[model samples]
Target: MVISFLSALLILAGLVFFLGAGVGILRFPDFFSRMHAAGKGDTLSTLLIIAGFALYQMRDLGDSEASVSAVLVALKMLVIIAFLYIASATSTSALAEAGWEDGNDPVIAPKHENRLAGPPESRTAAADLNRNSTHDSQP
Candidate 1:
């Protein structure tokens, strides 16, 4: 019961991170910001959710065939977690690099500045302007 409850709690926390990532991707002004959200949130959420399931799988650990199978499944989950950690980071970096090479500029603002605190043109529009300049400069 305790294991199940803990697993559920972890899964829910993971879901919250997933929600945060979704909102960040939608609300962020540019490519690099969205990638930051997706990369960090997606990686952490996946890890948390998988860890929960792995914990749940250990609920049956004992001297029996079912226990052995549970252990195997937990190990498999661990492998998946490891693979995702590497793959997600690699893919995020690759995509970000591709966007940078394609002349997508990030939305840079002052520290502790609200995104909406600035004039509208100073927000994403500025990023667009920068991107255009970079694009024009490219041969």
Candidate 2:
């Protein structure tokens, strides 16, 4: 009874974390921040959900559930966690990349994706770099 109760509570908490992450993704003002919340929160939520499911299944399987099928199911769950970890990290990296396509990208970031704090470097360095690049391109 106690284990089942804990499992239910854990499942509910995991769902809350997942939903909160979705809201954070939609509401965040910048790509990096959105990706940050989405990646961390969703990963944690997924882990929690996986753990809860594993516990629930274990309860059902008990000594009987410890068969090969149960082992396979648990192993599959572990694989899923690993895959999500990699995918979330890759997607976040892609979001934070600055090397935009020359012609394919829009002229500017959407207001939602814009950051209030400018990049680490000031406008002077950026201008210098921009000018140097343009000068070099004038072949």
Candidate 3:
């Protein structure tokens, strides 16, 4: 009974994190922020949920007939959780780097610009401005 309650608690906590991730993905203004929410929340929630499952599986371990298989199942869940932690972090970083390299800029409020003017121009436009300024300076 105690094991079941603890398992439920962990699973519920994981679900709450998952809900937060969903809201962040929907509400964050930029890709990186959304990815941050997804990666962090996904890794932590997966770990918690799987850990709860592993703990719950062990509840049957006291039974001689089910001990070995229950132990093995719990071990497998643990391994999965470990792999997910590494993979989620690595993938999130890689994706964020790729987006940056591809010129996806974060939304920064311009000091003098009116709020209703919408976001600044695209990265290509900025790059063009730089090139034009460099050419003007050279000659």
Candidate 4:
């Protein structure tokens, strides 16, 4: 009972983080901010969810008879969590760096008219201008 409760809690927490990441991706003003939210939230949430699963797998563990299969499965989940922890961060960093190198600039807040509050057309125009500028500079 206790193990199940804890597992549920962890999974729920992970879900909450995932929701936050989705919101960040939609609401954040710039690429870097979105990426930051995605990378951090995804890594942490994934670790939490996997850990919860591992713990739930071993819920039957007791003093007398131990399940070898359960232990092995938990260990495998742990290994996956570890790999994801490293790989997710590395990949996010690489993507962000590539965007930077490709001339993606962070949105700076100005005192006057907020770019974020502007219309979709204006935003697309700005993006188009940036894309055109990058192309013009190349070759």
Tens digits of per-residue lDDT for model 1 on 1-139? 8999999999999999999999999999999899999999999999999999999999867657889889999999999999999999999999999987787866676664544335556664877888999999999
Worst 10 residues of 2 by lDDT: 99-108
Considering every candidate listed, which one attains the maximal TM-score?
Answer: 3
Compared to the true structure, candidate 3 yields what TM-score? 0.79
Q: Tell me each candidate's TM-score.
A: 0.77, 0.64, 0.79, 0.77
Off by over 4 Å in 3: 112-139
- In candidate 2, the residue pairs with backbone N, CA or C atoms under 3 Å apart (3 or more residues apart, or in different chains) clash, namely 61-65
What lDDT score belongs to each candidate, Candidate 1 first? 0.89, 0.71, 0.84, 0.87
Clashing pairs in 1: none
Cα miss at 18, model 2 (Å)?
Answer: 1.4
lDDT of 3: 0.84
Clashes of each: 0, 1, 0, 0
lDDT of 2 by residue, 1-139 (tens): 7777888888899999999999999998755567677888888898888877766665655567356687678778878878887887787666556423221222345453323334535433767878888999999
- In model 4, which runs have C-alpha deviations exceeding 4 angstroms? 63-66, 111-139
lDDT at position 87, candidate 3: 92
Q: What is residue 67's positional error in candidate 2, in angstroms?
A: 3.1
Better of 3 and 4 by lDDT: 4
Misplaced by over 4 Å in model 2 are 60-62, 98-139
